[model samples]
Target: MDDVTRFLAEQQYVELTTFRRSGAGVPTPVWVAPDGDDLLVVTVDGTGKTKRLAHTDRVELRPCSVRGEVAPEAPRYAGRARVERDAASVARVKRAIGAKYGWWYRALTVVEPVLERLPGRRPRAAVVITDVVPLDS
Candidate 1:
């Protein structure tokens, strides 16, 4: 694995900053799984981050605490984000998340279908990030 991929794969959380059409950044701490040279983040459909991605692919990422706190010296990277909505790809990402996160993610997968039936409870999808490049912190 490359330095960036190795570093990222070791992280439990990453602050994913997705850009809005108005040029504002909305950062959220997310579970990330390395897929070859790329990264995948699974999130609920119709979220602000996913919605922003439909407008543009611009994104930034950095290691962060589970609560979304970024360390002062955390390295940052820029990349393009794509929302993957197809069933096969989303299923693959869910498996990746379950492998990395174990019980919590796996449990959610079991209940997700039922939960998604609730009002405003959307289905999950994967956000694939590519062309990652290190940026000055």
Candidate 2:
């Protein structure tokens, strides 16, 4: 990761803005962590955000303050996110995010263990790794 990518990954949270099927905007708060040279974001498969990403890989991710307020006119980073479905990668990514964020992510882990041996209650999907190329590229 370059300076810009590294800096963006270090932020507490990122605004993941995707386009709705109706050509409207749908933004959500995403927990992201750096994966060597890419950004990894976690989400379920049946979500609207996932469907939107399938239609258009293009997305805007902006680093926000800890208080969750972004500067009114701050510059946002532009990139495309390719959804990944690898088990190992997803586990590693989740751990990284939890470690960096500390408490909140840890809570999620407590609620849902990565390796669940339950018979009928398994997670359908893990996480989506978004390999980002700067907009200027």
Highest lDDT among the candidates is held by which one? Answer: 1
The regions of model 1 sitting more than 4 angstroms off are none
Candidate 2 TM-score to native: 0.77
lDDT of 2 at 47: 78
Segments in model 2 whose C-alpha atoms lie over 4 Å from true places? 65-68, 114-137
Distance (Å) between predicted and true CA of 16, model 1?
Answer: 0.1
Cα lDDT for residue 22, model 2? 77
Could you estimate the TM-score for every candidate? 0.92, 0.77
1-137: candidate 2 lDDT, tens digit per residue? 77666977887787777887777877777778877777777765567777787788777877766545677765577777765557875677777787778898887678565455565554534444355545544
* lDDT values, one for every candidate: 0.88, 0.69
In Å, residue 60's CA in model 1 sits off its true spot by 0.4
**Which pairs of residues collide in model 2?**
none
lDDT: worst 10-residue window of model 2: 122-131
| lDDT by residue for model 1 (41-78), tens | 88888999989999999999999999999999899999
Task: Output the lDDT of residue 35, model 1.
Answer: 78
Tell me the lDDT of candidate 1. 0.88
